[model samples]
Target: MRVHIATDHAGLDLSRYLVEELVAAGYDLVDHGPAEYDALDDYPAFCISAARAVREDREAGLDSLGIVLGGSGNGEQIAANKVRGIRAALAWNLDTARLARQHNDAQVAAVGGRQHPREEALEIVKAFLAEPFSGEERHARRIGQVAEYEATGTVAGRLEELRPREFPAAREA
Candidate 1:
């Protein structure tokens, strides 16, 4: 599988480590990176690039995924999700990592560099990479709803029907 990775200065070391480790593990890797630490570097540019790569690769029928990292990973996750057709999940533990893939079929995972030790973070990434989407009917239905809403501005069912209409003008007091 192809894995794209990106991060700001906060996660530079971790990102580099992951790149080397993942490459050694035989995964095709793309590093959309700062290339050097800069305290003022922004996460959005790199994370969005990585996310876009994943989306484009998938659209081309390639098996690909992404990882965005930062000090807390919160901003990185938000940035990645801004890309169309990208489902980015913040994973702090092994279970969350696994579930992000198994349940949501997320294309990108966000990890916090300052939140855990390097080994634990590596384990979390491993779990994320190893788990496969369950492909259950319920999960597929839910993912489809999200994808539909993303493509269009609306979703089906009650939410669509309940869209608020403009209120009639009230009589002047």
Candidate 2:
């Protein structure tokens, strides 16, 4: 499997460590990186690049996945999810890592570099890479619904269709 990784300065060390470790573990890795630490570096560009690569590779029928890292991982996760067709999950532990893949079929995982010890974070990434999607009917149906919504901005419900529109004017007190 091909594993793509991206991170800002906050997670630069961890990201570099992961590239070496994952390579040793026999996974093909693509590093979309800041290359060197810069305190003011942004996460969106790198994370979005990794997510886009994963989406494109999958679209072309390749087995690929992504890993995005940051200080808290929240922003990285949010950035990765902004890419259409990307299901990015924040995984703080082994179970969440496994479930991200098993339940959601997430192609990308976000890890908090400052939240755990190096060994623990490595274990979390390994768990995420090791688990296979369950491929159950319920999971597939739910994923399909989400993908449909992403594609059309509509859902099969009474909720209003999502679109760009002005909000109602506020009432005077």
Candidate 3:
């Protein structure tokens, strides 16, 4: 599987560590920069590029996933989710990481470096990589609900195409 990772200054060190780990694990990796650290560098640009690469490649039927890291991962995930077809999940622990992949079929994982120790972060990432989507009926149904929301800006179990009518209920009465 191919993995792409991107981050700004806050995550630079962790990102570099992950690169070495992933490369050693024999997975193809794409590392989006700050090739050299810049304190003022922004996260969204790098995160967006990496996240977009994964979505586009996956849409083209390439087996790929992405990682966006930051001081807290909140901004990175939010930016990644802005790209249509990218389900980015923030992973704080092994269970959450696994569930993000198993239940949501997320293609991008957001990691918060400042929130967890290096070992714990690595474990969470490992869990994310190891888990597969369950594809069970319930999981599929829930994912479908999210997909509908993504595509239509609404969700299932909500009123559809509500039309305002003055006293329309009078006819029914």
Candidate 4:
């Protein structure tokens, strides 16, 4: 898999570490940078760039994913998600990282630089890259709902399925 990564000044060291380690692990890595750390740099530009690259590559039939890093990863996740077709998930642990790809089929993962040590972060990224989407019926159905909402701003088909199910306890009340 080709991994595209980008980060702000706050995540510069972690980004570099990830790039090196991921490369050593035989993954094709692209670093969309801040080649040098600049305290005033913003995360949106880099994060969005990485996200867009992933989207484009996927559209072109290439297997690619993105990593956006920042101090808290919240802003970076928001930025990456702004790309129309990109699903960016904030992965704080191994489970979240794996679930992002497995359940959501997320193409981008946002990692908080200050939240975890470099080694732990690397493990999270590895788990994210290694996991494949489960492609189960329910997960695909849920993901389709999100994609439909994203594209048309409306949900169609099976309104009854979307309706909230009443609880038996409420009926008893």
The digit string of per-residue lDDT tens for model 2 on 30-137 reads 999989999999999999999999999999999999999999999999999999999999999999999999999999999999998878999999999999999999
Question: Distance from true position, residue 161, model 2, in Å?
Answer: 13
Q: Candidate 4, which ten residues in sequence have the lowest lDDT sum?
A: 164-173
* Candidate 1 lDDT over residue span 1-173, tens digit each: 99999999999999999998989989999999989999999999999999999999999999999999999999999999999989999999999999999999999999999998888988999899889999999999999989898998768774657857799999999
Against the hidden true structure, what lDDT does model 2 obtain? 0.95
CA RMSD per model (angstroms):
4.6, 4.4, 6.1, 4.0
Per-prediction tally of clashes: 0, 0, 0, 0
Candidate 4 per-residue C-alpha lDDT over 28-53 given as tens digits, one digit per residue, 9 for 90 to 100: 99999989999999889999999999
Better of 2 and 3 by lDDT: 2
- Model 4: CA > 4 A from native: 157-173
Task: State how far residue 43 of model 1 sits from its true place (Å).
Answer: 0.5
Top candidate, metric lDDT? 4
Tens digit per residue, CA lDDT, model 3, 1-173: 88989988988889888888878987799998879889999998899999899988888899888889999999999999988888999998889999999989999999997888777877888889878888888988878878898898888556475667776345653
How would you order the candidates by lDDT, starting with the best?
A: 4, 2, 1, 3
**Window of ten residues with lowest summed lDDT in model 1:** 156-165
